[model samples]
Target: MELIQNTPELSAYLAASDVIDHEHPLVRTVAATLRADASDAYTYAKAAFEFVRDTIPHSHDIGDPRVTWRASDVLEQGTGICYAKAHALVALLRAEGIPAGLCYQKFDVVHGLIAVRLPGEERWARQDPRGNKVDVDAQFRIDREQLAFLIRPEFNEVDWPVLFAEPHPAVLQCLQEAVDEPHLWQTLPTEL
Candidate 1:
């Protein structure tokens, strides 16, 4: 079941960040390109999600391992891990006036992405722009959630960060500068 929380405080997720960089030219350009002709919030959000998930290949999966942490960098480079991709999605959604935030789950390590407050829905829905792996495809669904993996207590994956108004800085930095795949995977942020 999806956890539903729609407090007035969620509005803070709409702000631009140093990492999210919603005001950056690349973010704006990419957002405009993805959201073209989308008349509704759901449509716009879906379009943005699809673009990020399919258009931007995962840094490691593409055999092009370049650490890009900022939303603008992710948009410009057309690749990133889940954290950077989530930052881009948050920037695009906030640019379009939708309230979006970051959420984290542990699998292999702490993976992250944007949690969108879907149109006409009080609860924020998870929309991971990171490309699919195995049987998982991060998608946009307002009624029920479909994410990469569910948390298992046995793994000590207990610290799930929800409702982050912006991307966590340590995560951004670790991903932004990682030079190789092993290091990237090793550097996944678990602290915040």
Candidate 2:
């Protein structure tokens, strides 16, 4: 399916999610500012990714119950654990026409981050919310060859089994649902 890029549609979707609030101001702001650029999808995705990575701090203790904190919270506070930041990134990228999705791996302290694959891209790379850099060639152990095209030389391979031995069942379920139903999340208007 084609990714949604227009502001009204994207904003409506995000507002409905209720994930973007005053706390997560950056997500909303970025979406509004970048929507006017008219740049290619990848460029918008990269810019949004970098902005989130630089803005939020990496922490393992921020989100309680591991799911309550949404992108809005992270954007407003300027600090979030990995999962919250990833959610914000996902919302922003999808608003700009990039085909971004969530992928799950078992991790001990940190929650799974966002993974975005551009159209016609062969590999899926992990998005580091702390660094704001895409590890194009990094391995998460699902399959190297399948992700070879997504690998980035700058990022060290992520050890899947060691990082996430027993993935959270709820998180895995959410990731699956998100990938399966790409259009469920909505974005709101800038005025709202």
Query: Residue 44 deviation, candidate 2, in Å?
Result: 0.7
Q: What would you estimate as the lDDT of candidate 1?
A: 0.77
- Give one digit per residue, the lDDT tens place, for model 2 in 11-61: 332233444332245655778786667366666766777677666654433
Q: Estimate, for each residue in 1-192, the C-alpha lDDT of model 1 and write its tens digit.
A: 354333347668787878878888888887787778788889999898888888888887877767787889888888888888888888999888898988777666678867888667866677677788777776787767777666688978753645678666677677766776568887776666
Model 2, C-alpha of 96: deviation from truth (Å)? 1.8
Highest TM-score scorer: 1
**TM-score for each prediction?**
0.87, 0.50
